[model samples]
Target: MNGIDITVSTRLIQGLTNLSLGHVIMILVGGVLIYLAIAKEYEPVLLLPIGIGAILANIPVTGMTEPDGVFGILYNIGIKNELFPLLIFIGVGAMCDFGPLLERPYTVLLGAAAQFGIFGTLMLATLMGFKINDAAAIGIIGSADGPTSIYVAAALAPDLLAPIAVAAYSYMSLVPIIQPPIIKALTTEAERAVPMPYTNNQPVSKWLKIVFPIVVTLVCGLIAPLSAPLIGMLMLGNLLREAGVVPRLSNTAQNELINIVTLFLGLTIGSTMTAGKFLQWETLGILGMGLVAFALDTVAGLSFGKALSILTRGKVNPLIGACGISAFPMSARVISRLGLEANPNNFLIMHAMASNTAGQIGSVMAGGAILALLAR
Candidate 1:
């Protein structure tokens, strides 16, 4: 009996001795991600699965993440090959309605202007000692465009992709909390209340809608070939949506396909967040810089909006500038709410949508530009 007890104790000691600190830290990080997803409602669709994957990846005996594990297979199939991001873009494009942007082509500039955050943040990160490629990856987080951030980060700084993606999605969801204060500070109550008359002057032709995605894809591809895969997939999805003859295909892209791919993407991303990689001083710094990037983006967008107001002789509500952060209809809705608060009679949703959609396209172009500049 004593001999048996001694053998059992030896085995337990050996097991404990094999445990790695990195694994423990990763498990804790996974727990934190799960809590954030469930309690804070922070990108639950992605974060929850990612959190689970992180937990699974860090288990001591599970060499699953090492060579033959399910996650290892997933990582190889989707992420390493760059299949998932492109697939997700298909869904994003299919779901996106370009009508708002098409109705006011001028608003595309607002989107373009908002991309200042990505480049500006890149320069700032470089000043902070990050290499150019790493800075570019980190900077894209400010665009509040999750997939584009993921694409750029994966291409330029795969090591930093996990944290950058988390930060981008987190900030995107928090747009309501983040943007209002900036908007209020920049514009007085009267400026927020300024109501612009909506003109039904432009009707988006079906042909225009069909051609818009194709033209953008061609133009962006010619300028930044690296972005072609992302842009092509995105445009293909949009074409399906606008063609009016592929409801089934569009529905699959928007629903079943997207749902399936998001699961794999989230899990694969989480697998990359092992404690060995994530529990570093650089991770904290990246988080901090991400917030700075977000704030600067809001400043740039709102400042441009203020300038547009001046250009339009105050007919344009400067508050709509905050919508240029690419948080989509949420940012637009926030602008409309603030406008109503300042003056119950004011409605800026349509105008805000124009800038909001513009921000989306602008973010993609900015991501492409950064890839072109840095990947070289």
Candidate 2:
């Protein structure tokens, strides 16, 4: 009986039931992601869960993402149905202070100008022989908005979602390393030194704050009905913040609610990066285009800023223009720091934040346009 039990156990560990080469490779990938998250301190909140999920997913015959499994349930309920990303948007909206964007309307123009990277990359992807929908999904990495990227890819090209998402988040976390070099290469010392004073001295009436989101929702809904869910959820979150009647709800949305969704979001996105899905020559192309897209966005944003600086008699620093991607305060901080480096007294955070906020809206708006044109 003992011998028979040993034989049965041996058979259990054999065959495809055990680790395959692909599974091993994927586990290693998962480990690398975890290492980056822990050791390098890169996007730890998202990356940690993602790495753990990837490893869990690659185990042989685990059925962890099967119809009834935790991952499967998460994907079906959150990602596949496109609910979690929108919920996270609510959190994002709640955290943002749009006063800066409101103060400087022209920075909205900088936000619009920076979006050329999306289309420019689309053209490049087309020339590389990607299908139109595939190219559109790939091009949106330039928007530097991971949730938006995931939404577009899930709709237009679900197959490319893994690489597109990984690329988007990776670049987002590397903003400090990537953006400064581009800004420096594009601007002269004098241009960087140009101080952009906070011009919006008028107090933002609380009434206008409440009204702004409602107006934006109506406009976005009319122009791009498909984007209504995205725009609506985002506006609702902002309304919760600006309305000031529900501090309890606002705090919940900003903290606990968003935190939970983000953990699931990261894990689900990572699970999609199985070896079979991610290991491809096409994946390489997507990664390459992602980098190019970000670089182009920075360059285009800075160029527009320089034009504004010239037009406004150096009153607008070109450094603020570099903040015209959807990376939020990080991008703004980069430009502000660069400005300070050029001159100790050049405090440009509020000015750069104006463009950064505008970029967030511009990115979502651009996503709306894509949905209108591409979604059938």
In candidate 2 the C-alpha lDDT for residue 207 amounts to 89
- Number of the top lDDT candidate: 2
Clashing pairs in 2: none
Give lDDT: candidate 2, residue 159: 83
Clashes of each: 0, 0
Give the alpha carbon lDDT tens digit for every residue of 179-263 in model 2: 9998898888998988766655787888888998898889878987877887788888899999999998899889998899989
Best by the TM-score measure? 2
**Mind sharing the TM-score for model 1?**
0.93
lDDT per residue for candidate 1 within 1-376, as digits (tens), equals 9999998897768646667888888888889989999999988988998899888877766676775788889878887677898898898889888887888777888887777778888899999999989998999998788788888888899999889988888788788888889778877998889997778766789999999999999998998887788888888999999999999999999998889999998988888887778889999989988888888888898888889989989988887777887777678888889999999999888888889878877788788878888785
Model 1, which residues run further than 4 Å from truth?
Answer: 1-17, 201-203
Instruction: For candidate 1, give the lDDT of residue 4.
Output: 98
